[model samples]
Target chain A: MTEKIVIGLDGTDTGERALAFAKDLASKIDACELLAVYVIEWSPFTFQTAEENERRHNRREEEINLAMSRIVDPAVEGLKAAGFKATGLVRHGDVAETLNKLTVENGGTQIIVGRASSDGFAKRIFGSSTQNLVMHADVPVTVVA
Target chain B: MKNFVKFGLTAAAVTVMSSPLAAQETPGIDERVNEAFAAVTGPFVSLIFAPFPGTEFPWIVMWLVVAATVFTIYFGFVQFRFFKHAIHLVKGDYADPNDAGEVSHFQALTTALSGTVGLGNIAGVAVAVGIGGPGATFWMILAGLLGMASKFTECTLGVKYRNEYPDGTVSGGPMYYISKGFKELGIPGGGFLAILFSIFCILGALGGGNMFQANQAHAQISGIVGDYPGWITGIIFAVVVFAVIVGGIKSIANVTEKVVPFMGILYVGAALVILIVNYDMIGWAFSQIFVGAFTGLGVAGGFVGALIQGFKRAAFSNEAGVGSAAIAHSAVKTKEPITEGFVSLLEPLIDTVVICTMTALVIVISQQLIVDPATGNYLLNEAGTAISTVDGNTGVSLTSAAFGASISWFPYVLAVAVVLFAFSTMISWSYYGLKAWTYLFGEGKTSELTFKIIFCVFIVIGAAASLGPVIDFSDAAIFAMAVVNIFCLYFLMRVVKKELSSYATRLDAGEIKRFSH
Candidate 1:
């Protein structure tokens, strides 16, 4: 049976480190696949005007396209060029939940993400995605420093 | 900077045009302008408000009531049956994460609510109770309840018949549904009714949506500051409004969307405070509303007058059956159009049954209306308007006085809220009017700009004009929308019924997915 690892990408240097760690871990094991996922943070609770609401569908589409092109695509391409089996996914939702859901659906054995250095006030009040994933993931969550 | 320069130039031009009237002392330019407007619009206004033959009630009010009743019965009280589901939809419990669009049920409902819950709730309720007596409140609540079904019907059609462009933007309203639904049914004259509905929507957007908001906003501001030329207020409002709509200032529109909802909560919170403080009078106020609803409490025209005022204000406030809210709700992201229909029923409940009732209760509890001890009827001045304790203050002023009597600082907060409400309503209506404009003239940059400019100019006119002609014309234009919209709704309600039963069967069969616990 192939071991599947889900790597969360933020299009940042920290995220690249997490990818490198996940690739290193996958190489030691035969028949391993990497699933790169990018989640755009969105909340349905935000209020919008009529005009804004009208344009929101298009805006969401634009956000998804930008994420796939700029973040998920590059990571997946690099993994493929390195002769590793990899695929990319982009979605709009809370970051931790989307990543966890992707892992479960894809039968990923482990989840990997980078530790973001900035712990802002909001993140403290509402735990960071990494913190949430570490606490709640069904599979083991590997946090790369 | 370019937008600012353009806005500054327009404001300067408007100020220059209005200065002559401000400088002149003869009858004042405000009165002269109002008189000219009244003269032109008088016949149309009278025709719209014309009483039914051998009856004092305006046929338009009855038309709305009857349509609401029909929809309520036809849908088997869909508003009541699915009301709990509506709340769940808004809470996103039934939301599919993979829905094609981005707008949630909550956002759609809030956007529609913001448009309907404006000056109509603040001032319109005062006018209802003031003229129709406390009994009007009873009828107003009933109209709100029945109107929910009308919203469900129109909004279902709004989503089902919506025109989704290749670019992903959608447009839907009475015009789209009337034409498309009628064509589907092989009905003739759908084209004519669609065109007529679009025309009425544009006029209603300009009159009730634009001018009435501007006029009442000026009234509130002038009440706070000392009396000044209304054109001054008009020009300032016109400039800000012009900047948002014409100049494409999304920042202003964004701020307004966020702030207005907060203000709505603040206004309601203050009303709750006042209601709690006047807890002792709550029973008396409700009893007055009940008795006045039946007896008219000696109000002129008795029970019929209360019924007329209640129906008229509820239609104006909740905008159910008016077809404007359908436009707002149509953009919601849902494959099942009936889901949006269910969500929309909550609009009238919030706008009229809850918020408007709060305003009415506050006015009654404040003891603002002077009741003659001998006759038990409200004291009427020479002009026959009810003499309130606040020197016959009407509209927002009367409402402000009622709140102020309980919370002294409330009137100040209310003044700010009123201005914000006016600005937000104007912005929303500009979009509705522009939709109708584009529907008629075809979509293009120049056509859009022309309508925006005309809309801004009307804001100035709305602010400058007196209450009489502005209110009359506004009422006429809005009811005119109901005339076309409700007629089409009768034809399209079966479509909604089919959708509702399909949705219900799916839910009962466990086909509908619930995303959250």
Candidate 2:
């Protein structure tokens, strides 16, 4: 059976490091496939005015397109060029939840994510997405420093 | 620095000119401004509020009631049958993960709710019950219930005929549905009605949405901080509103979206506490409502009077059939236009039926509205208005007094909530007005900015002026919107029925996904 690995992309150098680590691990494993996923952080509970709500769909699509072109698509292309089977997924939702859901759907054996810089007080109190994934992800999570 | 000095000097001159001491010497600036506005707006106000021939009822209220009733019947009591499904839609049980839009059904409802759930619930209900007696609450609840079908019809058509621009931003409201739905049905005069509706929408946004809100927010603040020049409060409000609109400050909008709902909950929570504490009076309050609704409790016009106030306030509060909520609901991410309509019906139930009723009940039970024991009627003053225990306070003050009587500290919290409510309403209506303005003048930054500046200016004018002509003009403009909107709803409702039937068929066939357990 093929081993599927899910890599979280944040469009940063840290994400590149996580991808590199996953790629190195994939080379060691036989019949491995890599999935590059970019999750746009979104919360449904926030209030918006009529105009804001009207524009939100367009904005979400723009963000997804931008993420696909600038991060996920290039990474997937690089992986494919380097002789690895790779794909891309972009979605709007909680970062950890989207990542985990995608992994479960794809039957991913492991999830890899970069350790995003934790700077804000909210992050300290609520814990980072990496922490959340580590705690709740069904598959093994590899966190790159 | 030079511009700041110039602005400061100009403000100081206006402040001294309009000061109370200067007013004591002669007719004040406030009086002059009020008189000027009253003169210009008087005839229009009279025309709008004109009693139906040989009756005390205003034709506009009749227009709204007839439309709501027709919609309710035409849809087979949709508000009652689909009420549970509406809740399911709002909860995202049927939300397809692949839906195109970012706004969930819940967000659309709250956004629209914040707009409609302002002074209408707090002060408008007070005015309704104040004059109409407790009986008005009964009609208000009934109107709110029927108004759900009105919202459902307009919102479904709103989504069906919405303008999806090349930029991906969407615009939809009565204007869109009236014009597009009519055209699709091969009807004439749709364009004329659309233009007329836009004009009324702009006026309604400026008057009822901007001015009335500012006026009430100023009144509440003055009640708390002791009387002062309203222009001071007006200028402050104008500056903040200008920042939110012209400065494109998302943070302010974000903060308002977060805080106003919290305040709404806090206001309702306090009302619930008072209701629980006065549990013995609940039955008595209901009796008063029922009795007043039918008998008028010695109010000037009696039964008809209570019915009028109840319908008027309910129409104004929930804004069902008014088409503004349609604009907000049009943005929801649903392939089925009827799904948004289902979600939109919950608005009136929350606004008038629940919140406005709570305000009315609190006022009734607090003993603020004094009643004569012998006559079993509310005691009337020289003007034939109900006399309240708190110095015969009316509007927001009466509401404040009612809550204050129960919690003592509630008036202060209420004052804060009133200001926030006013601010949020102003923001929402600014967009509504801007949409109308753009429809007339075409979409561009200059047209948008002109409306924004005008809206902000009206805020100051609203806060500074007395209730007299400002409120009259506000009511007139808002009802005028209903007149044009409901007229269109009558014609376009068939399209909505079609959408509803299709949605129901698909839903029954299990074509619609249910994501929740």
**Candidate 1 residue-wise lDDT, A1-145, digit = tens:** 9999999988888799999999999889899999999888887777788998888888989988999999999999999998899999988888898889889988999999999756889988998999998988999999999
Measured against the true chain A, the candidates' chain A TM-scores are: 0.96, 0.96
Candidate 2 lDDT over B6-91, as tens digits, reads 46544543443344334444546566767777898899899988999998889888899999999999999999999999999887
lDDT of 1: 0.88
lDDT at residue B293 of model 1 (Cα atoms): 89
Q: Rate the local accuracy (lDDT) of all candidates.
A: 0.88, 0.87
Every candidate's DockQ is 0.67, 0.66
Q: Estimate candidate 2's alpha-carbon lDDT, on a 0 to 1 scale.
A: 0.87
**Candidate 1 C-alpha lDDT tens digits along B428-504:** 88889988899899999879878887887788778888988998999999999999999988888888888988999
Best by DockQ: 1
Best by TM-score: 1
